[model samples]
Target chain A: MSTIARAPEPAKASLVNDPKVRGLVYQAVLVVVVVGLVWAAATNAVENLRAAKIASGFAFLNSTSGFDIGQTLIPYSATSTYGRAFLVGLLNTLLVAAIGVVLATLLGFVLGVARLSSNWIVARVATVYVEVVRNLPLLLQLLFWYIAVLRSLPEPRASVNPGLGVFLNNRGLFVPKPIVEGHAWIVFAAVVIGIVASIAYATAASRKQTRTGEQSPVLLVALGLVIGVPALLWIVLAVVAGNPIDFDMPIKGTFNLRGGLQIFPELVALTLGLVIYTAAFIAEIVRAGILAVSKGQTEAAHALGLRSGPTLRLVVIPQAMRVIIPPLTSQYLNLTKNSSLAVVIGYPDLVQVFMGTVLNQTGQAIECVAITMAVYLTVSIATASLMNAYNSRMALIER
Target chain B: MSKRIASLALAMGLGLVGAGLGATTASAQATLANVKQKGFLQCGANTGLAGFGVPDAQGNWSGFDVDYCRAIAAAIFGDPTKVRFTPLAAKDRFTALQSGEVDVLIRNTTVTMSRDTTLGLDFPAVNYYDGQGFMVRKKLGVASAKELNGASICTQQGTTTELNLADYFRGNNLKYEVVAFATSDETFKAYDTGRCDAFTTDASGLYSERLRASAPDDHIVLPEIISKEPLGPGVRQGDPQWADLVRWTHNALLIAEEFGVTKANVDQMVKSDNPEIKRLLGAEGSYGESIGLTKDWAVRMVKGVGNYGEIFERNIGEGSRLKIKRGLNALWNKGGIQFAAPIR
Candidate 1:
């Protein structure tokens, strides 16, 4: 213990036996192997492409995509470039993901709360739904929704008129689109003006309540301002400006419904499948978040003479969101990624249009696939960062 | 799921690497020699094309393209059973051939200029002369493709038919909606379910797919052939000797038909004194050996899978359920485009 040489500093633990040095060496080896693999793969790709005389570059993106996508959110044609095709595919994917997120969140919240309800039937039913739906594969559920439900609808010639100028058929759901013209700008201006007034009124009313202890009917006033202003402007435009809003009603021809908006069955099926599938998982997350809130909070609210609705709304949801945000973010990402199953049902999402048809037509597999991966990576990163921002804002504070 | 896609990407990367390795390995030696060394032929075929390369319930493949592979095996080993099949999708067929995963690809692929020059593959000969056509319900009364204005056509996505349909419609100034599915079976399903007014594909495919329709008699294949689709077998580009062997193997089948050498009558005709027949059957000279084959290779192929005419009738022609008449697929002397080069 007191040796002056100290065994020559224990031989410096023999670099190999030193924990830190060993760790560094292992990590260095791992990195080198990974880099070597990647380098070999890249070189192989380059060499093979050159040997095959298949050009390897993104120049093929400018080439004409001579394939037709079944459903496109933006304008697309066979003559359109692969660049435009990729953009259309991206927009379609975003459209579905955005809509699916909104619908899934709303439904998931309702189902989660219902699952915790005192009513036995409601809670049991909610539990059964969550267990059953969450257990099935998303692709299988998608196929079920697409084939068994949507595709089984009546054919166009014998379409079911759901009334109000809407036609439901195997091809699509055709609805009348309002073709705004002339004085519609005045109506839009009134809506903007009303929204501004309502916001000002709400802030003032809330400030007054906080300062002077006077309850104002702010919600009623705000709703009245927004809706009444828009309705009055629309009426005045119709009366004085000769009917500004004209609906282009769908005309059911012998074989099709034309002249109005046509929502392809592909979109309907994909949205329905995504919504139903994602909501089950989101529901579980939401329930876990709600349950994570301590029972003391509810009891404390009750002791303060607060009603159940106010106590839950004012106390529960805000606190539960702290636990919910991170997992909820992941669920949203999963939903977005799962939307790629649109390829199977032919909904023409990013993977379907860009990664599939474009890759096949151009035979530029490397570039097309790389572009697709980059896009998904971008989408995932963007979504995660946005959610992370919200998460940090909601994170708990300690003194 | 992303991991699965990543692994798939890795596999594709390795495929490119394999392709580069194959190019170097294949360029130095004939694929014929490689096949001989391997002791069997590896043929790339369709994943599942009706009457083309579909496998039976027992997993034994038997189709037009399947038979062609068997003929190749027969030519090499005089045993048709020495061939193995690799089912490939439309997207990966060329890669399979270019990577040396298969000795030949007879997957009913259309021969085009870009495919010939680009993809590092060679189209030796056209076996099936096809063209894009439309099949509509008989009740629609659409006799020709020209009449199908404002029609909704169902087609498989990422296929030549999709482009052909667009071109035909644009050329004819017709407004149409295309409902594309991922598979021909799905396209047919959509068409059968009345989701589309018509189904479009190659003429032969139309004939075969029509038989799968709920009411086969209710659908009528339109008379108009929109675009020429010369379907053929393909091999890797670097191997000239291998390409020659595949080309002659196909040619031998055609020439055997021209010489009236039936599979049943091949043994008898091999003894014939006709110079052309004698030369073709290996009784005259060593024509087959030049392509790296035995002297009786043509005899083995003829006896194993029969001639082109017999194979055609058995798989996709009048003798099959498809009952597709030999229009463009008939021999040149019989008013068709199936003309082969002289064996000598």
Candidate 2:
């Protein structure tokens, strides 16, 4: 009320009125609550474990598993530790995932192109396949393959032999195993040398073509360098070093097949289910990617008097790949994750061995589950990083 | 701006930790009180095992393990219907118990050292004494498991059965192939389809599975019993009061059988002059009170579900299709191994 020097009144600062301050306070409360929760959970787990007299920690990793796995990529025994079982399971998972990805990609590309084929029947057939396979649940498809298809095969005594020393029975498919004896390393060395020489010849040929504008039949020369050299070395090794490649054919015993490399039916059924199921999705992705490229691009290429094959290879494909790559990476990841379904068919994948068998045996639920999750996470993260590197290279370059 | 967001995120994380910690600190010993308040005991059972725990077409559950759960219900409420059944898979059975989703798990689970110690479960009674055996087609000419060398055997994965099979083969220096499936049904199906030379599991399971085959008379379970499988009901640890109740309930059934008390005659036997029978029927002492149960708990259980012998005969004995002989499962006094401790 006393009108002294009237300086402009400073605005009163309220914590709720200031948005920044309010956000900070809310966040601070959240952090405190979350941290307290995590710490409490950890403490509770520890306390409960101690009270139950259950041993905690990862010391069980080195303990003798005292169990046998049906199929192991690494050399493992009942005497091996649980750690070895994990490695075996991991390798088996990677093997199937890698093979499934390769096969799915090849089949997907072919089916995708067929969906857009000029022939009406081809396009309709591809559409039917994609619709039917994609609509079915992968688990049911896997069960059907394992039970209805593979299990329905004839008995060991009545095995179907389609020639070439390959035998198919309910047990498995057995093929002639090539046992390389003495001096086989020389032939392998020669094959390696041939590959190196071919790469060198290819580089030189490409350089000559680029500089002098003189087209060399580099493909033919490289083929000769690769195949011709290998064949000549094989002939020398066979004649001079005594044809050491011996084939071990499977003999039909009373109850089973013996003495050959047998591909278990579980492996076959699992791979077929994964490849067929994932290819349907990948085919749709590929088709969409190709269609995403405008019709104007194709017309422009045709107007340039370029033929269909060259036009597709030089113009359309490069552009479509830019669209296809990111989705394709995701598809590969999906296939890898889906490989865990191998447990259903008893393929001895990581989940089956580590989570199913070892977990049950050890009764170390928390530890086993943590290890299994860590493995899958690492595999996925590694795959994503590799795909990202490839995707960035294919990304559109803006000036 | 980025610094502000970072600090905000950090604060949010701490708040979440507080919430989570608050949930985990709730430790209590009130399972008995909880069950009484809930009015119905939660019982975990097998999803479907023919002679053990199977649901009928009308969804009425009945089997060996199911009867055991009903027995517990009878002891608690004097009514066998006062129970809620949760059918759990082999892999999820322990988790269901540990998470307090079920009060007791009587799902034909085996009692092993690792399971008892590591999973925080207590198995107070061995209701079924089972052993691993192999089943083969009569035409396979395999009379014993030893003759199963080089045979592709169909077995369920994630079971002690698989480990035992491997052990038997390796010990005998024999080579064999295993065609494992995720479920017991799948293994049986694979064996039925002739994909395997033999099917292996518990002898009791083999008999049950054999009945489901296209030709039941064509399969014969081998005579060799490979491993000891003491199957029983599992309860969560840290609940001594609840565990005692379950233990005494099982013993009451056994003791009732020892005293020759059947469900049809339990009412008369409760008035018997024999002190042992009176004690078991909960008339002579305060045994039931110690376990937080009524004095008539044994009478209620016996009158509702009968003695252990009756339960066995009704479910898996000659009265049922499984037709398993109670050789090892017979009471210790009857030349077998089921020995229940004294309730006192």
Candidate 3:
């Protein structure tokens, strides 16, 4: 009836009928919404910044820090620039993360393998450790270790020495620091060359064995090549230079331990907490990786006259690694990021030094927070890339 | 039917999200204004430290720092009980103030240059004069800080004490390895276990900590004052009115002490003929209205909590278990820096 005055209809939109156009519109709307939210946040930040008259920029990084930090790996002082302070914090974070990763991995592998042991007692003990450590809240564990264990130790004068020139006081562990003399670089270079040579030879030997049925004693050969050269060089250097390396062991003085490197109780506890906490997670990963390997494969190797050690070294581990590595990277990243908790223990870590002191000094929150986040993200990404490459290499060779 | 229901649900979800965002923006913007309208003053304080801020068995906050919180509450709301104590740590204290989490920081915080400038906080007045001092086992036969060389000092990190330990040791050429903890309590505990040869912190703090010891007299605070630590109450900068209100409230305790206005006599002193007294007690007007407060705010503070000296005596000084002397916390008129600006 209304056709007498009919006008051509404008297109009515439906989400499904034209998903391309619809998706474009929806995406455009999302972009606008995101941009608007960002704009609002930035505006609010600017207003607050202006109200407080706080300068919002990175210029403060060049400003001299009027405060000082203890135990800086690089040169630092009250006159050090904010940038220098940031580097110190980053270095400390790397230090804790590096040490924690190594110790945790070692502990994890041992526990994971032990949990699968034929010895009932060993398996039960490993299982108990894994369950207890993994289930506990990391922060509570850290506090319990720091306050309940380390801080409860006796003072330095009444310190408990556990041999090896190591002092165990509430202050921390003081141990011998090896001072490497000039010719030490030669030993270090030799070790590096030895390692590369060993790896190259192992790869060739493994490839040859994989192609042919002939066997190569690769593990023994590699160990001999890698360790042998370094030991020989050290001996030669020692004989030629009279004293190639000297040990500066901590000796108790009237009021303090003098001459050796001292690791504070806070640091020791933090490392312990980090290792125990990370090891639990790493153990889970290791377990998963091992289990991912088919049980039938291990049985087959044993049926074919192979022992558990040889089967594990050659077959089961290679398969298990594929399952283990991705998760392993995540755990490693977590350990690195969680190292920020060192601030609570006054470990002078990256987060504590850079974000805590530098932020307090410069009052440049936006820049400082951004830089710290970027560093952590970069480190995590780099670590992940490395592990991923290893994982890819260790992956199965499919027909 | 299913398709129709899906569209309706999506539309409703979008609508709800839009409403939520609108509500959040409005609430965040009006936070500062809402605080004033609410009438109660919010004060941030330390969770537990002997003389600064500690919750008793009944959970009532009672300490020198808590008293200052009450003073601000009294000044603003005319009721000291109107305050809400938000416990904060050394690291989170400034952020809490900046984020409008609290109106004032009365946490026995040391006034430092970095805190003053970078934190965008204004330290209106110092309530306590403190200095870094060492505490050692009395059996060590250490009488003064200078007597201890090569001491394994337990120092709290993220504090000025760490830096001062280095300075003191370096200045005296006394080599020491510093064992650091995140909290003062932990640092002291380390020393208590004989893990450190000495424990170092503020002199006033050491006195309070000594009282909490398993045996109070087992440790003695050495006489050597390493560095000045002027502990004070601070508030956010930029709000001059707010800053002045907090400052005047802090300074009143000192002013009241100087004028002999005790809790016992404040009611009588309110009607005194002295021009300073008249002006301070609200017998005169227009002075406090400038800071958006009543003229009787000073009288309310003095009456609510005794003067700064009275607070000190009750919490940490000779009247308390700490038995700390009024060596540096005395009124400016009697040789301290607790000076109050005149009401005029």
DockQ (Cα-based) for each candidate: 0.37, 0.36, 0.26
How would you encode candidate 1's per-residue C-alpha lDDT over B1-344 as one tens digit per residue?
Answer: 57545555555555545434444433324788789899999999877778888888999998899999999999999999898999876666765676678889998889998788866778998899899899999887778888877677888776788889988888888778887766666678778878788899888888878878888999998889999999999988877898888889889999999989989999999899999899899998999889888888999999999999999999988879878888888889999889989978
Which portions of model 3 miss their true places by more than 4 Å? A1-40, A68-70, A147-154, A158-168, A397-399, B1-36, B112-114, B147-149, B166-174
Residue A99 alpha-carbon offset, candidate 2, angstroms: 0.5
Comparing 2 and 3 on TM-score, the stronger one = 2
Question: Order of all candidates by DockQ, from best down to worst?
Answer: 1, 2, 3
Residues B1-344, candidate 2: write the lDDT tens digits.
46645555454445444433432433435677888889988999877789898889988889888888888888888888888899886666776777678899998788888888887778977889898998988987878888776888888866778888888998998788877667777778888988889998888888888889999999988999999988888887888888888888888888988889999999999899999888888788988888898888899998888999999899889988888888988889899887888766
Query: Residue A89 lDDT in model 2?
Result: 90
- lDDT agreement with native, every candidate: 0.84, 0.83, 0.77
**Measured by TM-score, how close is model 1 to the native structure?**
0.91
- Worst lDDT 10-window in candidate 3 chain B: B23-32
lDDT of 3 by residue, A177-278 (tens): 999987888878887888898889888987998899778888887787778878888898889886677889999777767767877666777789999999
- lDDT score, candidate 3: 0.77
Better of 1 and 3 by TM-score: 1
TM-score per candidate, chains pooled = 0.91, 0.91, 0.86
What is the TM-score of chain A, computed separately for every candidate?
Answer: 0.89, 0.87, 0.85
lDDT for B300 in candidate 3 is 83
* Model 2: per-residue Cα lDDT over A130-240, one tens digit each: 999999999999989988666578888899999988999988899999998888777677777878888888788879988997877877877777778767777887898
Q: Which candidate is the best by lDDT?
A: 1
Give per-residue CA lDDT, model 1, range A163-213, as digits (tens): 889988888888889998888888788878888999999899989989998
